[model samples]
Target: MHAFRLTVLAGAIAAGAGMAAQAQPATPAQLAPIVVRDAPHPLDASRGDAYVATRASAALKSQADLLETAQTVNVVTRAEMERQGSTSVAQALRYTPGVIAQYGDTDVRHDWLTIRGFTPARYLDGLVLPFGARGYAQPRIETYGLERIDVLKGPASGLYGQSAPGGLIDMTSKRANGERVREIELQLGSHARRQLGFDLGGQANEAGTVSYRVTGVGRRSDTPYDHVDDDKAFLQAALAFQLSPRTRLEGTAQYQRIVSDGGGGAPALPVLGTLQPTSAGTIARSRYVGDPDYDRFTNTQTFVGYTLEHRFSEHTGFRQTARISDVDTDSRRVQIGLMASPTQAVRYAWAFPESARAFQIDNQFHTALTTGPLRHRVLAGVDYLRETAHFTESQLNILTNASGGYALFDPYAPQYGDFDIATPPDGLNIDQRRSQLGAYVQDQIEWDRLHVVLSARHDRVRLDTHSRQAAGTTTDANGDINRTTFRTGASYVFDSGVAPYVNYATSFQPVPGSTRTGAALRPTTGKQVEAGIKVQPEGSRALLTLAAFQITQDNVSAPDPQNTRFSVQTGQVRARGLELEGKASVNDSLDVSFSYALTDSEITRTNAADTVGQVGNRMAFVPRHQASVWADYTVRSGPLAGLGLGAGVRYRGSFFGDLNNTHALRPVTLVDAGIRYDLGQASARLRGMQLALNVSNLFDKTYVANCLGATGCYWGTERTAVASLRYRW
Candidate 1:
């Protein structure tokens, strides 16, 4: 089967190239092209743009055409996200293939979704964001400050050390581009939401050699879940300077504060009546298990980074980047246990407080040279990361084994007694220090229509953890792990714009923990084999891609089948899938995107000693079949020339909710719509202004997202509508 697939792929490439060559007249002017165009608005989002982005930088360390990258890469452009009125990074990726926008539909707290069957790491720019591995320390990137989002599917440990095997999502931040721009927006939406945002940028020096950009967003709102609030304040500033013709310097600083941000909102509550029928009655989606007095959550994060670049010549350049990050969070919530009886349940108060301080640096050197008829672009780089953190958890039992002290509650009719709120004492404290050092090399070899990429990386990872119990006695768990990963791929780009490619990549992730006698186990290893074809007719804005892949992961950490409390690294998972996607600027007035994915993911091996009976079950939260289509249209020339309309449909097939495959999550289909009008059409004074409105889950269809049996389940997001007015100068 593998040989046949490769044979067919090779034939397609040859035929495409042959047809293109015969169609285009061989001209000297075309053979030696002049005026190569730079990527269109790749690092900037405020300029004129389209839904389909032709280039991405995440596939390779440098910006390159996606057709020849030989990877399943998706870019969610700023224009596309803005048109849909996306409020979060996950929302922006709704239409992309293989990305589960909302894992269970209601995890508004963190970006808790999967890419290609697994939870992917979040990246800012080309570097890891260093979120804590044991706490609720995820970064909540404000979409308003982003230039774009690039998703690289499959293993990438060859370049990025210790990555999520399913893939990685990198957010490109907005930067100063020496262009005059000013924008401000006001928005109103569901849940009594109100928001204000602004982006202003321009040259800092008359020579246009220096530039600066400032972006900010502030909002306050109530959530559909009673007593929970959605509030945030964020600001980011970027400054760039062209010190010399071949050297440049850029710096950025960002600060964000969030209260009850889309995190842990679902985990704090218990589910019942929603899944089936409970003796208490059906629980409305608006049910809040946390008491208003203890429902507080706060996260404050700050980051500063700088980039220095110098070009020795047009063919060679070196760059170095460094960043410092500090994050802190404090949260309090009331937890509800499964119904003890038909009308009563146990409740408790819990607290999670954590903080982290981190530093990271990366240095790279890249050069291009030609040897005979082959063009080679070689890249060598090294990076280092060091992070120190304190993770703490506290609880006060209210009901039995529960906490702020466990109390008895009735779900059918809720009540918070007048008893004074109790404070939970820290029950567990963990101080951790983690670090990693990695070096990698990559070479892109090009000859005629054939492109080959080879890359390898090695990393040394160390973890030191100290745990303190309620008695104040502390114990340490420390270990060091080392691994090497690699990737190899070859692609053929036909003159007809057909590119067929195949690649194999491996991943390495150090499992954090110690064994019975304080020793490190093995790291989790993963490998993937991918083959795909990408077609983008010459001089066209449309791209169509079809791909098939298989991935296997080994050494997964699980509990000991022999001892439920101890862990062992003897488990495996396999995922195979087919994906089809198309994006295009169909015409001056229309833009469209569509995608379909069929994922077959299952647990292949287990330490039943460890996993109970989940060995052969499907991975939870991942659907077998998913598909979506979206389109936007505008009247280019007419009385309605400034009016635009958009609509999208998304479908997710049924899947299991538990590792044992007991709970079955039903399939669901959702619709989204948008409308925008250029206010300038009504008055010349509003030439640079616009007004827009967007609605998601238009029908308010309710569905179960995740299920853990009769004990609990999750609810999908409810209908949401927002309107905004914006002006740009």
Candidate 2:
């Protein structure tokens, strides 16, 4: 089945490439000048408050190189993605500092990621992707469908509205660049993994009045874990039209579907034993009872949006955007546990777990205005989001006789018998509704050889929740929650290759449930102060950035002194760090990018009984040191002009899994290498053709990527290699 799917995908890519090649070519006169910068720097001048996608050539800077703006940002480029053979967003982020990917039993589905000690907030073209506890199997948006990924570290509450303090990831989609282009790629790797993708963009009409771009990807792969497999498909299309000489309009839509049949969790480990744990030792006492027969999960997502822009005059313009998105997921999994005493005779019991479903709808609108000198760039936006989660949990209480002092179950099949079990109501439902409104203004001032920018924003957010259960009718005492936050920043530039900036930002998040004493906990607050310097020397293709930051979060919560399970707002945490990043293109033959971070996070105050000495302990999963480096060398002249060699290394320091800092996980160091050969031609049936090979985890290092408190820990993958072929016109 997987082979057939791969064949069909390959055929589709080939056909798409052919169609794109047969299309008419666009003339140079129709193409616009798109700037390519050495780093991911914000627009020096105000175009609008909202971020706009620029050309990849301009945004393909190193994660560290983008830190000069006083805001922590990481940029992952398409070239890096190809060289690393990144199959998913998680894989692509491996080399990014302060980001960690936690893989479950299956490699394709069931992957989770965290950034800056918190879960990642997914975004596509600056729009948030709805999330759920049960992993959303939404087809891992293929990198081939993307031009670049920008990660803004820390609370982006000012612009993103309701969000986590962790960070935000923005995926920039491939768009029409007023140039006729076509590309097709095929990848083959271990575990029978196969993938095919295609992208095409060009002017759709004469006079450069209309343009369009389309991208598609399909993949099928089997995991090393027993009895697990995954399949995914995706498609995206965009159209742009020049309404008038000063006005432009664009519409975009994308669809994705994914299906997976696998269920796995981290294996439990001993506390005071070896530095590096092995799955072999842990699985010995663990039964590989696969999830119930009905265990499977699937996800589907669709997004559509439009943007309109108009230039009122030479120095002023206005733009407005609106979008709607929908996501649905269905999952079923059986509860499995490990036995403490494997030497004793025992029976294994199975639960008849039913299913869970999540459905979400999101709508948003944004408008911006930009004007003249001493001028103001103003932005206003609003968003409405709704989510419904439903699940059915079955209670199982049965014991079966053990054979040879051990319980055994078939890996592919498991038996469940009813023995006086109580079943819950048909469905348990939880519904959430969120509304947000925001406004911001920024000013840009120009002097002889100096430029300065000042900006501020305010946001108002509200959340409402409702739930239905069989036990009794319960209403959230907090009812409707509201919060308001503010932020400000300033940047100055000098002609001598230096730009300095400072920023003060704030964030707020509401806690869902009330405290033990029946008092509603106010929203938590986070504040940060940061300063940075950016350098771009004259006649040099290198960009360097250095930054220092201090952040504090007040009104943190902990278990109530009276009630252990109930939480109370009586904690404060602080984090201070320094970062260095740089990117350079040396004489068009070599490109290098790197970043490093040193962070110190600790609890400033805590009322919890067990958290006194833990105040100075490091935050869970936050490495004290992290760094990455990637360099690629291309043959500039000769018969091998298009050949390239790439090498990269990523390192992370040891981190604790618990707040108390008792359980520690070993650090990880990974190396990757790749080689590519491009057959270049100006204009032909296949204007460009290329072949490449990538090897990840070259040394097959064994380490844990993440842990769930004391329960268990996830392990990293071994070495893997992939080969790919590409054609472009």
Candidate 3:
């Protein structure tokens, strides 16, 4: 029934589903606002906190043109995460482009990354941030409550639904806007790291139609290893209304708490003193393998969200979004078992405790149409999600029998007190449940400069598992899945701005446990083929993109080689890539960004007849080359006016941590620096004060950040320094 019918010409996330353009307030049958004079995109609503963002309502939910949305979208804006002082979300994506933000080692709970070669999917605003079955309950948000952070690359399950074909990461909190900001900050560096942060927004009346925002942060930290502790508490609150002109609303609440190590156990060391070198030499990057009065970790998170909008007949309208979540996790660690030589190691005491709950919802319908010269945009939707989790774990290990082994450890020379654990007999339980349902539709077309898009989606997934053992024994399991996805694209725009695009996408993932012969575990399919070229040189505010892509994934889940401890699902993987990027302001005292990437992952198929070459190898930590560049400068007038300077460089190229390709990693180059000063440009009692300094790996290099085999090696990330003081109104 394509008779839905015409006037939503501005797009606040209609079809791509980030439901936007204020997400509220539109009195019944609203119309009258459609201005297009020599417009090629650039409709209205110029970013909430501008730093050059030409729309990415999660990519084409609409404000269009990140080169007419053919895919490969990326934005990190809240002014590029405060000009790269970013503390988390993988350091604000480390200059994006085919991402790989901190893989394996320097773990800060979770935000571990990879893209273009698996593990992407994570969103919060457009839902789906659910991770079940419990593993420390995964929740860590609070990059100062976010305001931007989107990255959509390949395969999005036709419009989001059980993703991962190397793409997806949403985030975008910090709501209630019309732009009236207030800020505060206090931070102290290195390991004694201390912090306090705040952001406030306004407009609660005066015909402003109501709006409010509050963001917070508090922290006490220490972690470069030893005893492992990093503490934090965060809060968020938002509200917005404007009910009528057709209807609008917004609401939010959030809270978070974290206490480290929950078996993250400081990089979880081993590989004989980190990648072979320990004869008591090296291996001291703050070393501490658990035991400061029995090592512990805690995590707690709570969230509530809402968004609504409506319009009945200027052409058609309706929208909705909802969320609810809760989680609590606790962990105890002593972990590092087995080495027993070279420099000695053998210990274990691990314990896990968890709880979780979640709910999600999304609904939408929008329409616009034209006949003669061709123009149409349509969207349809449905979504649902549910999750639940409960967990229990305990382990204790020590070798030598006759009187017993007593957890001995000695990374060169180290010792600690109070250790004895063997707790496991409360009821010994585990329960997990999951549900998902989705439906989708989309069509966006125009024929002036020629642009076309098509979308389709369908999904159903369910999982349930239970276990109870304290001697009595009980076990139950279930899994059901179904999927359908597709996407297609084409673009051509020229007015001296250039655009050339081509796209194809598909993805689906669902693999949750079992297969050591217990069966179950199937679902992993992917596809991608892309080609791109985009540039905005007409008036030059700068935007350039160049891309090439290829990807394939199927079944995954390897290692059986005829029963080598059982595990199978017939694996296959392949990735091909090339990306080049540039973002620039180039004037008003220069600002620049650059990126480059080339990946070549392959593990084309596994089970090589037990010969163990694992079929063409290469895919752990996937990196064939990477690059980055950054620049910032401000000093408009004479005498260092409001002064600022920044610098950056990053490169990483060597990788291999498992899957039959013998370990050997060496390739690094990093440098970052920053400085700022502007006491209100020097008068009026420091109008909005500012002072800053930053440093990251500025030459304190000591490598090896991956090695997944012989005990798991890891260590990378050294120099860090920070200083700050800020104020604004």
Candidate 4:
């Protein structure tokens, strides 16, 4: 049987088992039970507010307990991030299954993650961050302003409109909920890193009708690379107002500025200096591959958004959300040219001035009702997105030797001179615009232990591109694409607390170009089938889940066989995988999070004679096996009471570097450890004080993190340590 068929068969068997267990006669509820009080805070009572989240809203855009949803989704709560000292998305998802965080390690400025085998879309509070850094730079969100991060695995276009086949990532922002909140933190770390951060929030009036929150961070650090530094400042503010018992409105604003000499790591070479040593002497891990004078990236970003929601009676509600953002960037870099020899290489430089503006809005209506013996919850929404960007690129005149190109006698010791590099009169000037309108509807139905989900969406997308030059403005590409997608799933739960589920989903992405015949190409489409089993023992906080999935993408662009100069849409790729996750509290003092994944990806079909024979090759940068485990323990009673310790291990299998599979990367394993002490238990004066230390790559093991065929390879983060002092009220 085919792999897809096998997956379906397994799901059938699992579902049959669940049905069999449900057939047993109903039993009376047990009378003897002990009641335990929970934390007083509302945040602590909500789902996903604890380290081991049992509920999430990302998968279905509604709060649903994990076992009730058919898809595989994981939520990383704020408490987990604090224990790990995670300052970025990459660090927060380091232990998650089916997510490859920082796959390109070369770009430290961005959260470069690949879910399953493809790049997942990014969302902030359920709104898409369209395009990402594909053309222009965007602001990096501060972790201090986030309440949780959710990863929804597999195709989600049925609701999100445009998405990758792998999955989607959604971040929930921190907002005031009428509770008094105050926190301040100071930190010191390796590389002369220093930082300060604060968060404040409170209710404005005694009636608790108005609430506000503010978060900010400032940091400066010298990186491991020579002449490279990281500096940034960020601020975010939010306000909430309850006009009446049935109506609520919220507003948010954020601003960020950053200046950096380089992105991350040492400049990468080919296999040399990566898998093998440089022909010259060993290449320095801290080598300055770019000119210090010309290498810099500066950016400023601003965002404003609002959300309004109203409830009518007990079963009807409406919500509207809108956001707009602007980003401006100036970047210059003098990079290493092709190596002439082990010790010699040429140099080139380039600069870019870019700006982008984006706007988005979503309106939704939700209702709950019953039809006969079945209960139904329905959601209908309409969303709109508009984005425009302007960019210019300039390069140095290497031939003139006035300001460009360099001749390095020894790569280790570089020479810098006045390189005449500037934007030419005929430099490239590009203006691009994109707009999308989408409508979607979803219905969730339940009867006793059986539940079902169905959803559909339609999208109309327009793309326009123009080149502004000395002569005139020329239209590069302009077209419109329309698509409709769908998703359906079913799950059944047994009295024993075991749930078996299966789902199928479709996705689509608009392409902006034309085909060999000058006809606008259609959107790329993907289909996936997934099945999983979830176990949550009754009366316990422990959870275990296992899932299997297969996905195939079609309408991929490839070289036209009939017309050598054009392209066709006859390409296909397939990915299949198994994932396992377990979260449990071994006791009152110990908690563990563990996960593992096995993925197999391949380019099944394609055009072009040069690549036709390479159809079976594995996709690049996708590890076949990956696993991680983390454990946190606190001393409840002892001389060392109030002390907490955490440790983790992460392992990734080797992977290929390019489509041709010419270069390979070695597998690696890393260790992390952290320790913290709460001073509140020691004295009343220090009631809200705490001190903590965290270290990653504890062994300082040096390894090649990743490599791009023609670009460069990067070394993983070395041993690093940080100490923090925090106070809260």
User: What's the lDDT for all of these models?
Assistant: 0.77, 0.58, 0.73, 0.75
Candidate 1 at residue 40, lDDT? 40
Q: Write the per-residue lDDT of candidate 4 for residues 86-180, one digit (tens) a residue.
A: 87888888888888864433344567788888778888888887453244455566777788888999899999988888999998777677667
Pairs clashing in candidate 4? Answer: 402-420, 403-419, 403-420
TM-score of each: 0.92, 0.80, 0.32, 0.90
lDDT of 3 by residue, 1-729 (tens): 001111112111111113344332335554664323233323223333554565676755545658777877877777666766778888778877788854533666667677876778778777877565755576877787887788888888877788889888888776765457688888888888778787777776678667777777777767677767677777777677767767778777787777774344455677767667865776787787666665667777888877787878665788888889887877777766677777777776656787778898888787878879987788888888898988887535442334675556776677775545454334456788888888988887888777888988898989877767667665666788889998888888777678888899888888765565566677889999988888877655567889899989888887576665345777888999898878777776787888998989898886546476677888877778888988888897887898888888878788787768787677888887888888888887988988887877778887777777766667776888778788997
In model 2, which regions exceed 4 Å deviation?
1-68, 102-107, 132-140, 264-289, 292-294, 334-336, 342-428, 446-453, 468-470, 517-521, 559-566, 607-614, 680-687
lDDT, candidate 3, equals 0.73
lDDT of 1 by residue, 222-318 (tens): 7777766778788888788788987888888888887773234764334457766666567777767666666577788998988888889777888
Number of the top TM-score candidate: 1
* Model 4 residue 384 distance off true place after TM-score fit, in angstroms: 0.8
Off by over 4 Å in 1: 1-48, 102-105, 261-264, 267-271, 279-281, 399-406, 471-474, 561-563, 608-611, 708-710
Clashes of each: 20, 0, 11, 3
Specify the highest-lDDT model's number. 1
Give candidate 2's root-mean-square deviation (CA, Å).
Answer: 7.3
